[model samples]
Target: MDFDDTPDEAAWRAEVRSFLEQHRGEHADARAWQATLYDAGYVGVAWPVPAGGRGGTPMQQAIVDQEMARLGLPALINLIGIGMCGPTVIVHGSDDQKQRYLKRLLRAEDLWCQLFSEPEAGSDLAGLRTRAVRDADGGWRVSGQKVWTTLAHLADYGILLTRTDPDVPKHRGLTMFVVDMMAPGVTVRPLRQMNGAAHFNEVFFDDVLIPDAERLGEVGEGWRVALTTLMSERLSLGGGGTAIGPKPETVARHVAEHIGALPADRQVLARQQLGRGYVAALGARYTGYRQLSKLSRGELPGPEASAGKLSGTRSARDLADLAVRVLGDDARVAASRDGDSTWQNAQAGLPGIAIAGGSDQVLRNIIGERVLGLPAEPRADKDVPFKESVA
Candidate 1:
C-alpha cells in the first residue's frame, strides 16, 4: 500500500492544520476545547458528508487524527457517539434516523454512550439480560441495568442492546435501540475508578420507553446490528495508541529534560524506559496508518486490529508504570506532572480495556479463531438461551 498521501489529501491535511491553528491553538482544557474542533469541521473527517463529515477516506481520517494529536488538542469526548454510534446509524438506521442523529453527534451537539454490557454479561455479551418488552402503543419498555457505560452521565442518547426473546438462542433474540438519556425511567450513576475519576457508570433502565422508530434494526437482528457497531467500536478503540499522536515523544523529551534537572546519581534505568516508550509510541502512530490503509481499501483487519489495541494498551500500562517511577514523588499530584502523566487517567483505566471492549483473553480468542484459523474453544452454552446460560 502507498504510504505517501495524494496531493489532494495533503492539501486537506494542510487545511485542517490551518483551521485548528487558527481557532483552537493547543490551549489548556483540551476536553472542553474539542467543541471548537467539531465546529471547525476537522472532527469526524472520514464520516459521510451526509452525516456532517468531510466524507474523506480512511487514510485522510488517519491524517486528521495524527494532526489532532500533533496539536495536543483535547481528545474528543464524544468517542462512543461519533466513532461507534454515528457509524452504526449511518449503516443501519433509517434515513430519518440518520438525519436525526448523525450530524448532531458529529458536531458534539449530543453526547452518547454504549448500553451493551449488562450486570450479567460482558465478554459473553450475547447473554445480556436487559429486557425490552413491546408496549400497547408499539413502543418498548426497557428494564435492566448496564454496567461500565463510559460517559453515561454526559450522554444525551445511548445505543442500547436488550434481550427481546429469551426462548431463542443467545445471539438470535436481541434488539438494539437509541434511548434518550433523560427519559423518565433512565438513571445514570457514576462508578469511580482507581484514578479518582468517574468516567464510566452503571445505567439503569426502569421501564424506559423508546419509540419503535428508534430501534436500529428488525427485532432479533440486534446482534447483527450490534456487530456492526461493535466492529466499528473495536476498530476505533484500536486505531491509535493510548499516547495518541505526538504525546509520547513529548513525554520522552520531558522525562529526559527532568532527568537532567535531577542530580546525576538520580538518573537511572527510568530514563531508558522513557526512551523505549517514545519509540513504541512512534511505532503505534505508524501502525495506525497501516490499519487505515487497509481500511481505505475496504479491508477489515479483524484480529490484526487487536494487535494495535494490545500494543496501545500495553504501552499505556507501561508508560503509566514508568511515569510513577520516573516522576518519583511528583506522581502524587492530582493533576499531571508536566504532561508526562496526562495519561495517568488512561493508565489507571487500561485494565478496563483489557476487560471491557473484548477482554485481552477474548481478543486472543478472536486471534486464535480468525487469524490463526485454529480450532474453536469448546462451549456447551453456545446455543443456549440467554436466561439459561450460567453466569
Candidate 2:
C-alpha cells in the first residue's frame, strides 16, 4: 500500500494541524482538550457518523494521531473509553445504549475502565470466575474481583465481563455489562508497582446491582463482545513510536549522546545495539501500518494485532535496556540523586507491557494458530462445563 497520503488525506492532515496549532494552549486540562477534540470531530474519526463520530476513514484517524503525537499534545485522558469501550459498544450495543454512552464518552464527560482481568484469569481470560446472578427485579447482582484494572479508581463507568452460566463451556457462559464505578458495593484499590506508581487497580463488586437494561450483548455472548475490546486494545498498545513509552528515535538520541563517554571498546557494542533497537521499532511501525490498512478497508483488526503488540513491546523494552546500558552506572546515580528517572522508570515499567495486552507466549500462540494456520493445540477443557472443569 502507498504510504503517502492521498490528496484528501493530505488535506485532512492540514486541517488537523491547523486546529491543533490554534488551540494548543487553550485546553491545558486533559478532559478539556478531549472535549475540544470531540467538538472538532477528531475524537472518533473511524466510527460511523450516526454513532457520534466523523464518519471518516481510518487513515484520517491515523493522521490525527500522528499530528497530535508530533506536537507532543496532551493525550486524550479517556483513551480506554474512546479507544476500546466506545468501539465495542458501537458494534454490540442497542440504540438506547449508544445514545446514552457515546456522546458522553467522546466528550470525556465519563471516563471508562475495562473490567476483564482477575487474579486467576488474566492470560486465560475465558477462565474468569466473576459471577452475575439474575435478580428478582429483572436486573443482576454481580460479585467478583478484577485485578490490574487501569484507571478504575478514577473512572465513572466500566465494561465488565462476568460468568452468567457456569454450566456451559467457559467461553460460552460469559456476559458483558456497562457498570457504574461508584455504585454501592463497588470498591477500587490501587496496586502499587515497583516503579512507585499505582496506575493499575484491583476492583471488587459485592453483589452490585445492575439493571437489565445495562447489559451489553445477549447473555452468553460476552466472549464475542470482549474480543472486540481486546482487538482494539492490542492495536492501540502495539501502535509503535511512543505508544508504549519513549520513541525509538528518542532512545537512539540518548544513546548517541552518552555512548561516546563510554570506553572505546564498549562504544562499538552500544552503537550496534542502538541500531538493532531502532530497526525493530521501525518494523513495529510498519506492522502498525498493516493493521491500519485493514482498518482503512473497513475490516476489523485480526490476529496480526497480537504480532504487532508482541514485537512492539519487546522493542520498547529492548530500547529501554539499551538506554540504561549506554548510561552505565550514571543511570542509577542520576535516578537517585537528580530524580531523573525517565529511562529508569521506562526500564521498570515496559516489562509489564508484554503482560498487559497479552502475554508474549499467548500472543505467539495466537499468531501461530490464526496467522500461520498451524494445527491447533490440545485443550482438555474445551468441551467441559466451567464448573465441572474447575472441579
Candidate 3:
C-alpha cells in the first residue's frame, strides 16, 4: 500500500496542523484541550456521527494522533474513555447509553478506567472471580476487587467485567457493566510504581449497586463485548506506541552527548546497541502501520494488534534499558538532582508495558494461533464450569 497520503488526507492533515498551531496554547489543561478538540470534531474522528463523533476515516484519526504527538501537545486526559470504552460502547451499547456517554466522554466530562484485571485473573481474564448478582429491584450488586486498574483513582466511570453466573463455563458466565466510580461501597487505593507514579490503582467493590440499564451486553455475552474493548486496547497500546515512545534518533543524540564520560570500552558497545535499537524501532513502526492499514479498511483490529503490542512494548523496554545503560551510575540519582528524569522514569515504568493490555507470552500465543494458523494449546478448563475450575 502507498504510505503517502491521498490529496484529501493531505488536506485533512494540513487542517489539523493549522488548528494545533493556532490553538495549542489556548487550553489551560488537558481536559480543556480535549473539549476544544471535541468542538473541532477531532476527538473521535472515526466514530459514528450519531455517537457525537465526526464520522471520519480511521486514517484521519491517525493523522490527528500523529500531529498531536509531533507537536508535543498534552494528550487527551480521558484516553481510556475515548480510546477503549467509547469505541466498545459504540459497538455494543444501547442507543440511550451512547447518547448519555459518548458526547461527555469526548469532551472529557467523565474519565474512564478499565476494571477488568484482578490479582489472579489478569492474564487469564476469563477466570475472573468478581461476582455480580441480580438484585430484587432488577439491578445488580457487585462485590469484587480489581488490580492494576489505570486511572481508577481519577476516573468517574469504569467498564467492569464480572462473573454473573458461576454454574456456566468461565467464559460463558461473565457480564459487563458501566460502573460509577464514586458510588457507595467503591474504594480505590493507588499502587505506586517504581517510577514514583501512582497511575495504577487497586479498586474494591462491596455490594455496589448497578442499574440494569448500565449493563453493556446481554448476560453471558460479556466475553464478546470484552473482545471489542480488548482489540481497541491493543491497538492503542501497540499501534500508538509507535508514535509515543522515544525515537532512535533521540537515543543516539543522548549517547553522543554522554558517551565520552563513560569507559572507552563501553562506548563502542553503546554505539552498537543504539544501532540495534534503531532497527528494532523501525520493525515495530512498520508492524504498527499494518494495523493502521487494516483499520483504514473498516476492519476490526485482528491478531496483528497483538503482534504490534508485543513488539512495541519490548522495543520500548529495550530502548529504556539502553538509555539507562548510557547514563550509567547517574541513572540512580533523583530527577530533582539531575533536572531531568525522562530516561529514568522510562526505564522504571516501561517494564510494566509488556504486562499491561496483555503479557508478551499471551500476545505471542495469539499471533501464533491466529496469524500462523498454528495448533491450539490444550486447556483443561475450556469446558469446565467456573465453580468447578481449579482455583
The numbered model that scores best in lDDT is 2
Q: Which runs in model 2 stand beyond 4 Å of their true positions? A: 240-243, 294-303
Per-model TM-score, in order, reads: 0.88, 0.95, 0.96
Q: Worst lDDT window (10 residues) for model 2?
A: 236-245
lDDT tens readout by residue for model 1, 1-391:
4576668777987987887778665446544455567676667878888877877676666667767777766667787888788888988899999888887787677899989987778888988889999999999999999999999999999999998998888999999999999999998999999777898899998998899999998999999999998788778877642343226756676576556545565576776777777677667656766776676666766454676776666665666666555656666663454454464665676677666567778888887888889999897787887667754
Residue 148 local lDDT, model 3 = 97
Q: Model 3 misses residue 58 by how many Å?
A: 0.7
Q: Which parts of model 1 have CA positions greater than 4 angstroms off?
A: 25-40, 240-246, 260-268, 275-279, 295-302, 333-346
The local lDDT score (0 to 100) that residue 242 gets in candidate 3 is 48
Q: Give each prediction's root-mean-square deviation over alpha carbons.
A: 3.2, 1.7, 1.6
Per-candidate Cα lDDT values, in order, are 0.77, 0.87, 0.86
> Could you tell me which residue pairs clash in candidate 3?
none
lDDT of 2: 0.87
Residues 1-391, candidate 2, lDDT per residue (tens digit)? 3466668777998999999998888767888889889999899887898889988877788789889999888678999998899999999999999999999999999999999999999989999999999999899999999999989999999999999999999999999999999999999999998777888999999999999899999999999999999888877776733455678889878987898889998999988888888888888878787777676666776665777788888888989988988888788786795668888888888887888877898888888998899988888898899999988
The better-scoring model by TM-score among 1 and 3 is 3
